[model samples]
Target: MIVQFKDVKDLTSSPAKSEKIHVYKSGENKGKTRKLNAKPARTGILPVSEKTVWTWVREGKFPKPFKMNGRTVWRLSDVETWIAEQESKATILKEGA
Candidate 1:
C-alpha cells in the first residue's frame, strides 16, 4: 500500500494494519511468515515538537528548511552540522563555566 501525506495530519497518522505478511528465508517467497508492523522513519530532524522547530526557524536558531516539490524539508547534512555546532557551543560554555 502506498501512502501520500498531503498535510501534517496525514504524516503523523498511521495506516490500518494488515494480517499475515509473507516472508521468505531463501531466495524465493516460500519459507516463514510474520506480521510486518511498518513504522515511518523519523530521522535527521530534531526531536522537539513541530511548533518548537518552527519557532527556532523564525528565531534563526535552526537551519532553514527548503521546499522540495512543494514539500518543506531540511537537508540531513545541514541538520547534522547544526547539531554538531550546538554540541561544541555547549562544551565551550561548560569549559568556561
Candidate 2:
C-alpha cells in the first residue's frame, strides 16, 4: 500500500501576507472591509516571492506589468491565460514522461 501526505506546516500556515483586506473609503460600502481580489504584479499571483516575479519578467518568462495611474499592474486575462498555458504544458510533460 502507498500513501501520500502534505507537509503539516503547509496545512497549518495562514494565508499569505499578499492577501490583504481592502477598506472602502468613500463608496456605498464605506467603512466595510473586503478581501482584496486583485494583487499587485510585484507580489505575483503565484506563491513565489516578489523578487522571483521580477526575475521572471526580466527573463521574459512572464508577462510584463504596466503602470496604471502610476501603479504597476498585470492584466487579469493575461495572467489567467499564462496559468492555463502552464497547466497545459505540465500535462503534456507528464503524459510524455
Per-residue lDDT for 1-97 in model 1, tens only?
4422222222223334555586777766568786876655443234554676777889999878777788886666676688899999999999999
For each candidate, the alpha-carbon lDDT, in order, equals 0.63, 0.64
Off by over 4 Å in 2: 1-44
Candidate 2 lDDT over 6-88, as tens digits, reads: 22122122344477788999979999999966533332247665566678889999878777676676766676677789999
In terms of lDDT, the poorest run of 10 residues in model 1 is 3-12
C-alpha RMSD for every candidate: 13.2, 15.2
TM-score of each: 0.54, 0.55
* Model 1 pairs in collision: none
